[model samples]
Each structure stands twice: as structure tokens, then as C-alpha cells.
Target: MKKFQPQPGFVVQAYKFALDPNAGQGAALRSHCGAARTAYNWAVGWVTASWWQRRAEETYGIGADELTQWRPWSLPALRKAFNEAKHTDPRFAGWWAENSKEAYSTGLANAAAAFDNYAKSKNGRRKGRRMGMPRFKSKRKARLACRFTTGVIRIEAAARHVTLPRLGIIRIHEPARGLLDRVQAQAARILSATVRHERGRWFVSFQTEVKREIRRVTRPDTAVGIDLGVKTLAVMADSTGEIREVPNPRHLDSALKLLRLASRTVSRRQGPDRRTGQKASKRWEKANAHRNRVHHRVANLRADALHKLTTAVAAEYGTVVIEDLNVAGMLRNRCLARQIADAGFGEIRRQLTYKTRQNGCRIVTADRWFPSSKTCSGCGAVKAKLPLHVRTYECDACGLVLDRDDNAARNLAALAAAAATGTGVAGDQGTLKRVSKPRGADQKTRATRPRRKAGTGRAGGAILPHQRQTETRDRTQAEALTLW
Candidate 1:
């Protein structure tokens, strides 16, 4: 398949709006999502059947040459086999035609991608964590979503409704004049629409290729470094020596009491039990929905805050410098996980990435081990150790006392300056060289073996073997432990 390449001056974007479908339309939407799930499950079962058959045959001492042929999981293969069997297959025989064909294709496409990922991971061709074989999705746990790439997908002239394949016109909760005007002016072309059921509401996202006009930042020659933390959402230090802090709203923490109360109320009601074949009482469903609403509100608030913060920063600065934080590793700290997650560190970086592009600003990511907080902004001296508990950075060399986050943000800003000047800053000697990992480099750990000689100690004299073999935790581990 050919990869999609947007035309010059055009970028792909998604415009999502909450749907306010009536009862009949809601049911139809559910049907389409159900059709997608059904198709996915069927594909999984059909492909894995041959695997089970081959395994059983081998156990019976059957020769490899006589084993059943393996099933293909490519989209075209799955579609061809599904079409041949849909008429006779009891699973989809009667109601397969109720929803648009795109519903089934979405599932098949997903299954194919899942299988491909599994294959790549197993062969060590994929990055990140390993993947397992595709499994059947449970009706109770699976997300409800369906994508339509064809058949009259459009925003109605009223800008208050959208039309999808087979589902016809459905009302939306908010006006879509932004997207409608663009579409009417031919500045954006809708490529597909995806309907998803989330947070007890239906939403449709239109994927489009939009010709965006990139605007210059307010301060075209300025650079700003952002230091993300739990106490403060972000501490930004600009090249002009202006420092600002965006306070953490702590939305989740503030709503914890309400969430706890709602959860306790839900526990008192008779909830569903799959093993017992008991359905939830209406009171239980209502209580559960209330709890979900609390979560939804928190999520919405966080997203809104992050978007506003990122947009402002991206629009004001010509260059934005952010740390390449190991957020996954940071989450492993039990004490700060909830607070860190609530701060939306990863989400902030993701939004800034695209937002900066649209604002015609450059974003520079500092190396994960850049030691931003440990580096002093006054004399450019890098500290050997700066514990998290020490919120005030006291520079040993220059006697400069400053807030820890403020110092870090200033140090980060210096990195951008160094890049622009093509000269190494005091604390960023090897930063450019270390930005990208060398080919075939092993993943780094937060610990290191002491570099002492087999019988030597810190004084460089002979020492015991046991003492020589003592392991040393890097600054990363020390900081992690301090945070914990």
C-alpha cells in the first residue's frame, strides 16, 4: 500500500465534536460499532483455528508436509474470506447488511494491523514492548468505535449536524462552523469520520487534510525553556530572563472527595456480576454513571488547561525547549504517580509538538539525562548531586541561590542558545552529540557498576574485592529514590 503524503502546505488534522444523537440514531451507532467488533472477533477466530488445528495434528504425529495450511491475516485475504462465508455463516448471515461495509472493514483492518504488530514484535523488528497474538475482544470491555471512509460523510449545511454512511443525519452537541467553513471554502478535505462512544457520550472525529497558514511567534528571536513538575505544572524561563510559573490545578486531587463518595454509593448498589449471571440494578447503573462523570470532568479540565498552556507558550516563543522526560519510569514512583499523571506531562509534550509546528516555532527536546535541575544557571557549574527534597538550588561555585525549577528552566534555555550559536554551553558540552542514540545501542539503565579497581577504594589504594564490586546508582536512580 502507498503511504499517504499530504500536499505541500497541507497538514492532516482531526476535528472532533460531541454528538447528540436521538434514541434511534444512538441504537444505529451502537449497531455499527457492534458490527465492527463482530468482524474483529470472527477474523481472530478464523485465523487462529488453523493454528490450533496444526498444533493438534502435530501432537498426533502428523508430518509437517501434511499439516493444515496457515491462515492469512492480510486485509484483502480477510475481506475475501469473510465475503465468501458471510452468506452461509450463521454468525453474520441475517444482520450483516444492516450496517455499512466500512464497519466490518474497520475491524478487519484492525485485526490485520494487530497480527502484523505481533509478527514484527516476535521477530524483534518492532520497538518498545513485545506484543502478544491478537485475542477476541469482549463485548463488555471493548471500546465502541466505527470508522467510515466512504458514502456521504459530511458536515450538514446547518453546521449543527453530520451525516454518516447508513446512519444518515445526526445532530451534534456543538456548532461545527470552524470545520464547515473550511470545508466549504475547500481549504480542508474530509478523508474519514470516526464515531466513538466514550464517557457516556457519542463523539465524531473528522480526519481531514487542511491547508493551514503558519503564523510567526510573537517573539521570533526569543527562546523559552519549560520545566515540568508536579507542584507547578510548568516553570518557563525565557531568554530575556523572564521567569513564569503555571500553577498545577490539581483537578483530580480536588475532586477526589466527590469521586470517593460516588464510588461508595455504587458499592452499596447491586452491580453486575458476570459469573453469577446477575445484571446491575438501575440504581447501580446510575451511580456508576455519576462516578464516570466525575472522571470525565477531570479529564476535560486537564485537557483544556494543557491546551491553553501549550498554545500560549508555542505562540509566544520562537523556540521552545522541553525535557525528554522518562514519564513511564517516573510513573513507577508510587508516591508521585497519581500527581505526575494528573499533571499530564506526556500530554503537554504531545500538544506542544504539533502546536509549535502550527505556530511556526521550533521545539528542542533536551536529552533525558541532561541534568537540567542539577546544572546551575549562574556559573554553569553542573552539580554532582541535587536531591529532589532540595527545592532551592545553591550553587557551590558561585553561591547563587535560586528556586530549583527556575534554575532548571534557565539551564534548558541555555541549551537552545548553545544550539543557535553553534558553541557548547558550560553545562551542555556533549548535548548535541547525545541527542540521538547511536545505532544498535543497548537501552540504558539507571544504575552503574563502580569503576574501582579489584582491590582499590575511593582513595585509589588497594581494597577488598567485595568493596571493589559495590554497585553505584546513577543520578537518575538517586533522583527517583529522592522523589519516592
Candidate 2:
């Protein structure tokens, strides 16, 4: 696949602002969102019916030539079919013209992407989380959203109001001076706008092609190593031997009491019973909204804290090294899951990645199995076992004691040092690659051996030397087993 190369001086960025829509405008926003959801559900049903028809035909022993071809799930095909049936389809015939055409297009685009992702995942061609087949969206559970691409999406000169295609001039809660100044100065162009209702309030986000100015770090040659944990959000050690520890806010843990109280209040109210077709009472709706607001506040607080932390680090350092943490595996620990998640390890790395590139800085990620915490930073000694309960690292070889996270951070900083000196095998000038562990005459651990040195019969992280030496001498005999 060809890589996407953005224009030299331009970058794509999004600006989101909270909206303060009046009652009528709020209702209109909800209506558009509902229309989008309806369109998505209709598309899903249509595709599912087509699949079932094909399956039924095959079961009836229909000839291959006579069987109906499977209906296409592409956006263009779905749009053509929907447009032809809208005038006669009972579900949409009455209200088809009430909303903008962009609403339907958004739903169709999403449906196409969903089907494509499902196919890729089923065929083992997709990465990350596996996706199931496209499912119908529920009105109550579905998030309210709609996007407008070919519309008059602009910020007013006054910097307090904005104009969308159909939804004209909605007031904003915060001043949009940053985006407005760019638009007025011809430094940015708005390409699309998405409006959504989230956490009991309305927000509009503009996707723009912005001309970004190159940024420089305060300390251009300084490299910092960051170690992330539940107790401390980040433990950073710079090239100057300075260590700074940022404490974890533990937002979720702090709010658990209020959350529990609010949840109890919601439970006491009369909620909707889906099986009995009973609607929720007003008290239930009010209680649910209150609970949602609390959750939203917690999210906002966490995001604000993370942004400040990442921005400062990215702006001050030229090179930042962080661990390639297995956050998914870490979350499996029930005892630390909530605290680890609240620390936002994944989010911090994601932000740092973009921020470093946007500025003229670089980021280096250590390999997952590098064993940073188990190694002694003072004397380059590797320990076979280091339990989580041990907060301080005590080196047996050098008798040097230090904080566990601080030792790891210092080890990560050594990687930067190696890369800077041109001694490490860093593939790219800016990207510091993983290096092999140094060989020691007294080393007994097979897990630390380099890939080339570790013999053929390796499984897991260790290799048994005697078992592998016998197999290498009888290579022809081992190959004969494949014939059977």
C-alpha cells in the first residue's frame, strides 16, 4: 500500500467547541441525529435481508447461474438503492425531506466502513481489535452524531458564533478565537464539520487543513526517559540526571463515592423496562442525566490534566523515550485495572506521538520485553525476578539502591545516550531502535541472549542449550519428519 504524504506545510487538525443552542435549535440537532441513526439502521436491515436471501436460495439447491447475486454494501450502491425507495418506503416516505442529505450520507459512509472492517477482520487481514458483522444501531444506546462535508462551515468574525450548512449561526460556549484568527488570516481551511450531542450537551467539531508553523523545543538537545505507572503517572529522567515524578490523579477512584451515590439515586427511580414496553419515568430520566453529568465531569478533568502534562513534556524535550507498554494485558489485572486506566498510559503515548512529530522532536519506544525494571541501571546487572511489591531496586552487583520507576527511567535514558553516540543500531536518525543485550561471561540467563545467538529450539523467552545443540547436528533427520 502507498503511504500517505501530507502537503509540505499543511496538517489536518480538529477544533471542537461546545454549543449553547436554544430549545428549538437543540430539538433540531436531535432530529438530525435521529435521522442519521434511522438511515444507518435501514441500511443494516437491507444488507442483512440480502444475505439471508442468498443463503436460503443456496439451501434450496438453486443453480449457480440462476441464484441472485449478493447485494453490494458499498456507499454508492446503498445510496442509489435508498434514493430509489425513499418515495415509496413507508418508514422514510413521510420525513425523508425534513433533514439535510448529509445526514443520510454520513450513515451510509459509516455502514460501508463497518462492512469493510468486518470483512477484513473475518479474513484475518485487519489489525487491532477484531470486529463482528455490522449490527443495527439502537435509538436509546446509539450516540447522536452527524457530519457535513460540502457545507458552509465557518466561524463568525466575532469569534463567538458559528454557521453550519442547515443549522445556521449557533452560539458557542467558549470563544473560537484561535480557529477564527487562522481562518481570517487564510492559514486554515475548514473541510468538514461534525455536530454531536455528548454527555448531555451539544458540541461541533471542525476538521480543517491547517498551515502549521514548525515548533522548537526549549532544550533542543535534551532527551528524557518516561516511565509510566499506577502510583505515579509519569517518572521522567532527563539527560542532566534530573528526575521528576508526576503523581497519578486517580480520577475514577476519587469520584467513585459520588458515582456510587448517583448510581443508587438512578436505581431508585422508575427506569424503562424494555421487555414490558414501558417508558422511563421523568424522575428516572432526570436521575440518569445527573449521573451522566458526573461521569462527564470526571472525563473532562482527566483530559485536562493529561493535555497539560503531555504538552509541557513535548515542548521542553527534543527526544523522549517511552516503553511499549502492553496496556491491554495490564488491564487484565483486576486489582490495578481501574488505577492503571485512570493514569491514561495509552492516551499519554498517543498524545506524545503526535505532539513530538508536530514539533521538531522525536520519540523512541523501547521493546515490550526489554526488561527495563528488572535491570540495574547503576551496574548493568539483570535480575531473574523482580516482583511488583518491590518499590525500590537494589542492585546485587553494585549495591546501588534507587526507586524502582526511577531506575527504569534511567535505563531508558541510557538508550537515548547510546543512540546519540551512534553506538546503538538505530535504524532512523530520529527513531532509536531496540538494541541487543550485552554478552557477559558470567551471564546464565538464556532469556537475555540475542536472537541470532539463541539457538533454534527456543520457545517462550528461554532456550535449553543441550536440547538445541543435539537438534542442530541432525538437521536432515529433523527435516524428514515433515514428509510424514
Candidate 3:
């Protein structure tokens, strides 16, 4: 029942507000976005051309040291190179100064990060999915976004308008009182502002360093576990033996028909053809907008539901336990991908991770391979195997019958105690344990990939210590030894 202590200094936070711009202002915003895209495309082309030149030179039997050096993709190097070329380069010579310099910097910064990630992935130093080389940003496919950091970015005293570097004062669709109040009280300082065009609307997000008050949970001694699924968005079980279920809203499923109709309408209309130089019809644009609106609505609904659920849990419970689901792997199942995506399993855990930390609550993530669903909550007996079709968990040893999700949630709840003690059992499974703590794992260890033998694929790398040992013996031999 330990309480969280207040941090010594401020924390960086973002405040995003929708914008309402005039026709002329919208045109200017689009111009800046285009400028950013142009700069990013130029950088990619320049770096790629340099690479091809070096490769071609090597093909001519040129010495390795004699070949032209490859151009670096770092931001400083890109900026210096662009500065020298802008005056003579026909592409950017005419109206490059129309937009703020920060626009170009934003693009260059993104390019640098992209190349860095690709290099890291090539060396097997980066985690998650591998990143490819940076490509030219297309006007039609790329998201329109620009960031301003060195210029005057501020909110007006009235909280009705915002001022950017070159964009000038633009009216805000929503009130900005929350951010304005903090700034006026000397509790926050704006660091940067990014303008983005999404779903046919413009939004400005301010990154600020703000002083947040330390929050306390309502029930400091209470602990609860969350079991996330498609049918029941979340099944909760608390230490008090009380269970709660939050029904899935199925926002995407509910709007699937509308989305399909809108998509069909768009497909029927005369859309833009870049190859043939054909412009999109007005009707096509309207239909495409309708389709985008449906998608945006679904995303907003899911985010709202997740926020409400996470807020309630973080504010009330002192310790929250949840399973570490392999969402990416789970989504590979074509049959359940749609339903699983609609459930927002990853989003739920993401929101909870931050909310719990902010509200002074602890989050315990059970190992991904933990057999929560295959263990008896009543007596801790581990089942040999449990299939997804088994909705009800019937324990043979303890004679406990309960809902599958509910039993998993209860087991997750018990993990908090096991985690605290480090050596305790969850149900009857003495060997069931967690690998990481609530905060996170060791950064040094987690950041480095495991070493593998030469000629072995990634799958053949070292396995986790908790995994069941494999042998050449048959199932009968393994069972016989267990009985003895």
C-alpha cells in the first residue's frame, strides 16, 4: 500500500486542439505542408543518388578509398547541403522562402530519423518491425504535417485562437482554456507546435513542459486484474472477489455497413489517375470524404471508450494486473483479425500503462506465455491444455466452474501478490511466475538482441527460461516421469 511521491520538476505533455481556418489560411497551411513534402522528397533523392553513384563507381573497378564518399542523411548534413543547393537548384530556387525554414527542418528531421532506424534495423539493433529505406513523400499518399519550434507559437488570452510562425492567427474549433490557464499561471511552457491535416480537418498540437499535481488512488490497498477479449472488452476481478464486465462497443463492426456503402460510392466515382493525368471528379472527392469520416468516427469512439475505462481503473485501484498479449501475432489470424482489431487490445494496455503511472497506481503485466486461462484459480491446478473454444473453465481437481475470461482475470489479480513476493505461487501452479516488473524490464538487457549461432534463423535463437524443455522422448516417457 505504498503511495506515489511527486516528481521534482515538470513533465512534457501535448495539448491538441482542432482548428477552424479561413479559405486563404487553409491554402497557406497546405502550401507549408507541400513545402515539407518537397524538402523530404529532395533529401531522399539526394541521398539515394549519392548511394547509386558510389555503387556504379565501384563497378568500374575504382579502388574502395578512391570512390566518392557517400552523403550522410543526418539532419545537420542535410541542412548544410540544402543550404548550398537552394540558391542554384531550379526546383526550389523560386519560392523556397515562401514558407518558414522550420517546415523544411521538420522534413529533414523525419528523414534523418527514418534512415537511423533503417540502419539500426539492418544491424539487428532495433526492435519491433524492420524499417526500410526512406522513400519520396507523395502528395496524395503522405500525411500533411509541419512542426514549428523556433518561432512564436502561442495561444491567445481569450482561448479562441492560436498563432503559428507564418500561418498567423487561426481560430480554434475547441476551447483552449485548459492549456491557456496553465501557461498564464506559469505552470507550463510551450516547446513546439505541430500542425497536421487529418480526416479533412486541421489540428494543432502543442508540446509543452507542464507541472502536474501528483494524483492519489481512491483505494490504495485495492488490486484488480483485467482480461481483454473481443466479446467482452474487459473482464475485471478485484481482490474483494467482486467481478465486473465491460461489454465491447464494437464501434467498427457497427459502422461496417456505412463504411462499405461509402467505399463503394467512392469506387464508382471518377477518381484521380496520376498515370493518365486525370483529375478526380467533385463527386469522387465528396464520396472519399464520407468514407474517411466513417473511419475517423470509429477511431474516436474506440479512444473515448478506452479512456473512460482506463481512467476509472487508474483512479480507483492501487495495483492493476493485466496480461501481456502478443497483439501483432494474434492479428495474423485472418478469421479473428477484424474482431481483434476492433477490440483495441493494444490501445487498452497503452492507455492503462500511462494512466496508472500518472495516477500513482502500479501496473503488473503477466508474461505473454503465462497460462492464466489454463490454470485453476481455486486450487492453482494447471491444466494440460486449454482451447479457445472452451468458454467455461471446469477445474477437475478443485471442482471449480467459472467463465473462462473471469477465471483468467481472477488469476491475473492474484499475480499482483505473487509479483510482490517474487517467489509466491498464483493458483496451484508453483512454477508460474512473471519475468518483468510493473515499471519495465532492464533497459540494457531488453535493448540488446539475443546472440544466435551462425546459420541459425531468428526462430532458432535462445529461448526464454520459462519455456517448457523439449526432448526426443515421446509423450508417454514424459508423462511417466511426471507420475513418478
Candidate 4:
């Protein structure tokens, strides 16, 4: 991303270039990633073995300097140590040592960083529980090539596609138009480029430190509040009362049949049992890979959709308002997990957060309990309860019957002004909506049902109601339905 300091304007722009590495380059990059993985595993084993021998369960005993002497954690250190113990250490030999220096560096960096993070957390300098020594990532995990740094990593102008320290130059999939053109004209210097293979494809993301251009907005006074949901995706309520819908991509349905077929194939193939220390057959591995491919495809589809939605929203809105969703809490509800994940509600908000800031826009977060859903967007009257099935908000006071998501979006927009001017509590969003009145008569409503939250369980069963419902539904639809 380029920042314009000289002109002092509120605009910044950045580009991500896709890499097209050759087969050899791909192999080399994989080699480094593999090497890094090996080194990481080796380091973990060494540290664990050392600790076991010392019988010191506490990570405090193994200092960083002491770890440096252990070898296999770093290149320079490992090479020197490797020379001395070429015949002594039975873990690995010449072939492993021939791997990229980056691999060893990765392991050492990972371990050091993990240890430091743990130390900081222990001293209450960071969040999360007190962590222990870094555990080695398994070989089954996908290899990562892109490395993070303070500055944006960019490609060199002369090379167009620069070679990494260990990985060779690979072609860029994209025609590095604006960025490359700008850099070649002495406007920008390409700092670094890293090629990464993720979800069955290779992509090169470039980070360039360049002179930022000043941009003036045509619609200077425009603002919008976005309320995200599982059913509607995103509802944007602008100051001009324009409401837009970005529908959730339920990719699971499209890929489910194929995924099921893959799963069946995997099951048909005799798989290994790790309890018996059995390795998987070639057929099983292939089937598993196919299954993974399906999962990857679904993930890729979701990513593409989110990217487009966020990018468009950022360019349009001057001030964005969104809710601070309790994704973790929502995930705990087994009934809604699938739908919520499909919507990618958290991802939408997350993208908006940085994108708006980058696009010279303001982002306002409504309190979790601000009653965006239950509040009457027309009259500002808050409600106590609104069931998930109730997709229309029927306000008794204002007689406003609107699309549930639209109403929520409008409510979010208004809440932004309130939130900006006042200090609101940061807790569950349930407290905001004091009551929700359905269209039913007051006496008729009171006779059968008492007041309760939308997700409230009327029957506090020893087992959840959804669990019973699921069992019954599964049995009823077992023959008719296919799950993937």
C-alpha cells in the first residue's frame, strides 16, 4: 500500500499480483516449504527429546541461546552442528541438510516467536492463556510460501518477477499493469514478491513501497451502514435510504454431491488405522486428496465472493457501520453454525474494517447488544424479541412492516450516530431489544406464550431440542436426502 505523505490526502492504494511459477520454480518453492516443515518437526523433536532427558516440563528451562546450540532449528547454526554430528545424529543426514536455508530459518523463527509469545502472555502482555513450547505443524497441513514483513513485498522492475532466496523466478499470472508500469517509470520500487501455492493453485502477492496518489471523492458526504446476516448476507443502508443486498453464497449445496461421491470413494478404499500404526494405501491417499480438492473448491468460491463484495463496498461507502458479531458464541449454537458459516458474516465485517480505512472511509461498530434486528428502523422503537423465522419486523407503535434484514440494516445506520456520540456497554446484544411484539393480539399472545428471547429454549431439556429434531429429521429424510 502506498501512502501519500507529501500531499497529505486521505487515499491509499495497493495491488496483489498473481504469480505463475514454472514447474521447476514450483518444485523449488515446495522444497523450501518442505524443508521449513522438516526443520520445524526436527526442532520440535529435538527440544522435546532434550526436555524429556532433562525431565523439565517447564519451557522456562530451555532458553533461546540454549536452543540455538541444539541445531536443525536454523541454517548457519544447523550446518555447523551438522558437520560435527554428521554420523552422530540418526534423525536425518546429507539429503535433508541439502534443503533450503529458509526451511531452517522458518523453524527457528517459529519456535522463537512462539516462545516469546508464550512469555509475553504469561506476563499479561497479550491475550489468551499461558502458552507452552511451540508444537511442530504436521506434514498433512498445506505448505505456505508467503512470508509477512513490515513493508509491502514487491517484485523488481528489471526482473518483472523476482526470484526468492531459494525459490526461482516464476511468471506472474497477471499482467502487472498499473504497479509495474508505475515502477518502471521511476514512480515506485518493487520491494519483494513471494509465490504461494494454496487451494491447488499458485499466486504471487507483491508488496511495493511507492508514492501514494491523492484522490478526491466525487460524493464526499456519502455514508452507509452495513448490517451482516446469515440469511441476507449484507444489507447496506446508505444516508440516501438506498438499501443493497449481497446474498450469501451457499456453495455447500453446489459441491455437496461431488463431496459425497469423494467421501464414498474414500470409504470404499481401505484406509489406514493410525491406532495400529498403519500407513494409508495409495488409493486411500488419492481419494482423500480428491475430498480435499472439493473442500478447497468450496473455500475458493467463498473467498472469491467475499473479495468482490468487500472491494465494491469499500469503493462505494465513505463511512461504513457494522456490528461486532459474536461469531464464537454463534458457532456454539449447533442449529445455526452451518448457515452462519455459509454467510461468512465475520469475514464480511473483517474485510470492511481494513478496506474502509484503506479507502479513506470511516468504520463504526455497533455494540453487540444495540438491537439492530429488533429495533423499528422507522420510528427508533426498540423491541424485546424477534424470532429468526420472523423475517418481517411488524412494529406496533409505528406499524412498520419491513424486510427483517432491511430493517436491521436501517437500524444499524441510525445506531452509528448514537454509538458515535455515546459510550455503550460491550456485552451480549440481547439486552438492547427490551421487547418484540408480533402482529398477534396482546390477549391472544399472552394466553399461549410468555416473553422470551428469539433463540430462547422454552423447554430446557436435558438434551437440546435441536438434537431431538435432528434425529427425527435424519431418520425421516435418510432415504430421500443425501448428506455430503
Q: Which has the greatest TM-score?
A: 1
Error of 3 at 184 (Å): 1.2
TM-score of each: 0.86, 0.85, 0.85, 0.71
lDDT of 1 by residue, 1-484 (tens): 2344456899889999999999999999999999999999999999889878978998999986787766667788899999998899998989999999999999999998887777555545568898887899999899999999989998888999999999999999999999999887778889999999998899999999999999988898999999999999899999999999999999999999999999999999999998999999999999999999999999999999999999899889998899888899999999999999999999999999889888888788887888899988999899998888999999999999999999999999988887777674322322343535543436644454335454332323332222232443122122221121
Clashes of each: 1, 0, 2, 12
Compare the candidates by lDDT and give the number of the best one.
1
As a TM-score, model 2 comes out at 0.85
Ranked by TM-score, the better of candidates 1 and 4 is 1
Superposition error at 205 for model 4 (Å): 2.8
| Tens-digit per-residue lDDT, 393-482, candidate 3 | 999998999999999999989988876786653433223444455444554465585665543323333322222245312222222212
Report the lDDT of model 1 for residue 346.
Answer: 93
Error at 87, model 3, angstroms:
1.7
Error of 4 at 141 (Å): 2.7
- Give the clashing pairs for model 3: 380-427, 380-428
Error of model 3, residue 178, in angstroms: 1.5
lDDT of model 4, residue 34? 68
- Give the higher-TM-score candidate: 1 or 2: 1
Clashes of 2: 0
- Candidates ranked by TM-score, best first? 1, 3, 2, 4
Against the unseen true structure, what C-alpha lDDT does each candidate score?
A: 0.85, 0.82, 0.82, 0.63
